[model samples]
Target: MKSAHSSWETPDPGYWTKQGYIIVRTDERGSGQSPGLLDTMSRGTSEAFFDVVEWCSEQPWSTGKVGLLGISYFAGTQWRVAARKPKGLAAIIPWEGMSDYYRDRVRHGGILSDRFIDFWWKNGVQPNQYGMPGRAARKWGRDTIEGDLDKATLEQNRRNQTLDTVTHKFRDEDYYKTRDYSPEDITTPLLSVANWGGILLHLRGNVLGWMRASSEHKFLHFIVGRHDLPFYYAHCARLQRSFFDCFLKGNDEDGWKSGKQPRVKLCLREGDAGVDDPERELLFPHREEIDWPIPDTTYTKYYLTAEQQLSTTSQSNVTSFAYDAMEGKPLCFTHKTSARLEITGHIVAHLTVSASRSKADASPPSDIDLFVTLRKLDQSGNEVYFTGTMGDPVPITKGWLRMSLRKTNATNPGHHKYLPYRDYFSTDVEKIAENEHYEVDVEIWPTNVVLESGQSLVFEVAGHDTQGVGKFSHEHPEDRKPEDFAGINSIHIGGNHSFITLPVIARG
Candidate 1:
């Protein structure tokens, strides 16, 4: 079921309606005007969506063919329903959708995104619930029938969803797996649109969905803008029309049928504010390739050295930095390149760390919570942040991990080199013994950037996000603002354990 408000309207329905195609938007069960418990992303919701699709195919005005297209919640539902492979479903465009509920939304890097979820529930879901009194209800009118459900039932549904997220701290739990759909189950001809700045919700799914989906006719496109802006943009809309026309209308003349569409179209940011242009035109330079994780990518390793420097050569000397887990600054390492470098694809950092009880503290910390950020710096050493999907400047990419959940899943294969999948299921939690060291691999979200000559790559290893400033501060309540962490954390560097692996693309 769609969780967002205004599910009835498509971004630009005229593009489809003008082509003589019927567009249907239904309020999902328990949402909008639909009568049912508002259990978000439940198996029941998926089955209900399937029933709607199949029913639509049998309608009098129907051609017995159906397709799905939408952004965010709409896009997310498409992934879940398509996995069921509903009969009469022809194609789907999951534009900027989050595939995995745990990885993409709730628990990022095993940390609860309490702020985002709380913001969503209060500002997004509650106000738009069937009979809620707010702007959405004033404009769209209340779903009086569904509103008939006792207020207690409505409050319980909201509470259940939030409680489920907080209680199930690990990903391997049944709560998360039941809501997660396998990309292998999605066989429909699919066009997945991803946004580069959608680190918080959209990017991971778009990229991972394309990689895992068993569909033979799948295509991926990357756009740079606010999460919802691309859906209505003429450039993206044209692409969507061509894809639907080729699959649904059997239009052989459509560019997609002629093999003119690139398997991956990545947009590169050109200026400070990539989303500044009001029209949101595709103005940046881009690359077209047959697939993602570009074939000729050179995985480069930049080691964290004793002198707080990032270098290509591994050093034998071990380095350590201790910080108050709650208020200490991050351990940063900067490296300046001699020549221009273009980096694309997934990035992973191999770190060896140990935690201990601080002399000034009363009790020992059971686990170490680490937050890693990859950033760019100008020649003058100023931090470079890019405009994100929300119109705010954000660092290159960020990753987090509770050291206790750092065990890697050797059985689950990685999608790319240096990108090993970690298992949050196995609970092998242990406190650090004196002089004990643990090897942890942190997966920094995938990024595409062109580092000009003399530009420096800066890596920050901290207990919390350094960019949590002003309007952009969306932090995990516990991880970001811990009441008190009575321990000093250290990052060990030397030998083979401390290096950041970058997916460096070779230039001609």
Candidate 2:
């Protein structure tokens, strides 16, 4: 199989060699070893993977069938290539990689990703194209360098700005076209593996790909802990090897020999404070349930009361939180569990919001952020947090819609109602307006949880960061404390329209 490292590490040949699998690790186009313009978002990269597969099949040492493997960008390319239905491509194991560039990796809850492509390209993508800088040069750099630095060294970096100029063209047609994977075309068998903490990366896109693809033999596995750390474990590695062995080596029944349904494993760690959890902790594999928005769910609405409370009872003319950039966080609502219950499915948010800035001042329309968080409170009143596919601890179950991008799709049923899929949205160029109120829906990614009696299922609606609370939270020097955390958010509510929607779970 063909695998290449992101600007970081290349595939470790020693590991693949021991398994008797021939590994082809090359840099993506415009990256190391390869020559061409760098398409950071996997356009040319997908074609490269397809080319490698065909090459491998034709080689003397090759089997007719080829399987692709890798994590993050590598994992993502699997879907992009599979969508192309490359000849000789057999199956794919996209570990912790997002399927949709628009939904999972680049944007979250309609907010521009905090991890900007420009920043990543400048800091991560370019350096890998060149050899690692010497120790002296490393001191001035800002990325994951291991050494110390001085002021003069930092000054030198300001002049080396190739990445800065390239990534600013994010919305260019060339960039978007390079990353598109229109699912209707993908027919290959797929096994998507991800870390629960890798939530923002692979979690939703994995589920979306598994459910929507043209392929019938698709599966998903989510083993919790952190991103990329699972690959080092014995059990995890065995699972991956078995997957490739069955698909690539034509060992058809091998993966199912033990009578286990294809599973989604979630690592369960102790929720105690001050206890450091090991990476790739444990695996809890679940049998496939019905497709998401689980046919079994009741599309229930929890009214956002004028009093700022979430209750099952319906109310009208609610008081909304104005879209104040400086507003405090939204309040949370919890329900005491009367029985043991497990909620496994997608959650939706529907609210009416208005912007404080004028159309001239706003970035075109407005990109408003609504934060949706799901938490489980123990009987002792302690809160438990889960890690997202990004390998960060996020109480955030899912995030959606920056308001202005809330376009309705007349074709897709998933996009028709209060449940809005996080598909990409473009600007409505001619109709832009300022300080207008609009109703929109946000779909939080799917999650699986078991709540016991006396414990409550809690949902917090706020505009703030959920990262700093846990080890798995995505962080950087830029994120602020309380002002950005869940405690305060500014929202405006005045019309009879403001409210939040929930997929009410009911026992059969």
Candidate 3:
């Protein structure tokens, strides 16, 4: 019953209420009207969610069938509860919810994301903690109900929430796994909605849930827009209604029957503005498919060459570049295609990298942090940046990896010839030998992009993300500092060590 939607947001429940559906919204423990401390995604919250769903079904006004739906936090709880398989829970629409807390939130690609989490904690969740007077009370009157928790309880809740994310920076640890749930554990019918711009938190989870979930009725739709915008978008709302009606209300007219609904629907970003102007001036050209890693996908390898070029043919020459972890220049490779191309799936790059301590510094970094970004350039060689999750102009897709955690998971089913999965578990850590080359594979998230003829594809390898530029100033708090990265880094190309595999969708 806990609601992450603001009290002032009428459209969420308003849409359901108008459809003759009852909406039950409650505050979870330690927030708003709840009394206990906020434990974030702890097991306690999952149990409370299960209890509330069952309680709601028992009510006289209920039809004894319950379905879960929401965006972000509201959507996240559905994953946890569905895994528990609450009795009355019939269907779930986990719109933009992250399934793995470690991979999706605290540590992304084994790098701590302290900036976004800190910002989210201070600006997003703190204000809604139990002790603060409710927004309703402030807007309504002094007689209105204040939050249930006292001042002491609220402070303790804040401390606990902070420790949950900041304390543990490793993945698959007891702290993170205890609060995490596998998609395979969920048996309920699911409709996952993903946003391409939700790189900071939502996108990965949605895709992972769809790909890993064991549900036979699972459906995934990739939309073009900001994280929260798509949840209320008219098209998305209608689709959600159809899915719920088919599952929760036993209505077959909703167009969600097996063999009827496409397993994946991609909302391709078209036009110059990209997904920035979702309200207007942008078109969401959609493509439907029965599965992802799309069947018949043509995997093409683009080898990294010596002359700062990407070519289809492999090269034996080696290339190296020196970068000052914090401020060094990045190595870039460009490919100008003669024919138009459309890329619509996962991309993986393999590179041979090595690092050495800067002579000026007594101590050097034991491991290297690499940030890989794929960008596009127009015919005139101008960078083509798109509006991404942070509402700023960013490259198409970005990948990150800490060299020490680059061990591949041999047992992961998702790993194959073209696609390799990096295991972020603590056991996978293998320290890098100073100045010894190590082959590492970095996986960029799935994306749909159309490259016109004469346009060029650009790839950049850097020690840190570019910042201070116009519309690209955002930085993550967990970015490795200059002192920690006082070293010279090199990227080796040639032989079997350097190449990128791209899923090139065949065009008629």
Candidate 2 whole-model C-alpha lDDT, 0 to 1: 0.57
lDDT by residue (1-508, candidate 3, tens digit) is: 1135434322366577778788888778766667666777888889999999999889999888888888888877788889888888888998878887776666667777666666667666667666665545554322215535556656776545555655565667777777877678888889998777665576777887778888878888887655556567676678878887888788868567756888888876543554367664246577899898689899898988888888989887766766777678888898897887788788888888888888854576688887887878888998766656655666677777878888888688867766567657778878776789888888776677778888888878888766312222224543455555658888888877787888888763
The most accurate candidate by TM-score is 1
Q: Report the alpha-carbon TM-score of model 3 versus the true structure.
A: 0.91
- TM, every model: 0.92, 0.77, 0.91
Ranking by TM-score: 1, 3, 2
What local distance difference test score does each model get?
Answer: 0.74, 0.57, 0.73
Candidate 2 on 193-274: residue-level lDDT in tens?
A: 7555554557777777766777666666656655655655666667777777777776656654343544344333323222
Model 1 ranges off by over 4 Å: 1-9, 131-140, 143-148, 156-159, 255-258, 270-281, 414-416, 426-431, 468-485
Ranking of candidates on lDDT, top first? 1, 3, 2
Tens-digit lDDT string for candidate 1 (1-508)? 1223323325445566766778788776766777666767878889999999999989999888888988888888888999998888988999988888777777667767666676666665665565544434456455565335457766754435656676777766777677777878899889998887776777888888888888878898887766656677666777777788888878847567467778888787533443334444355688899888788888889999888888999988776766767668899998897887777889888888876666745566667777888888877777767657667767777777767667667777543456667657747544455447888788787787777777888888987657722232336554443433346778888878689998888773
Candidate 3 scores a C-alpha RMSD against the true structure in Å of 3.4
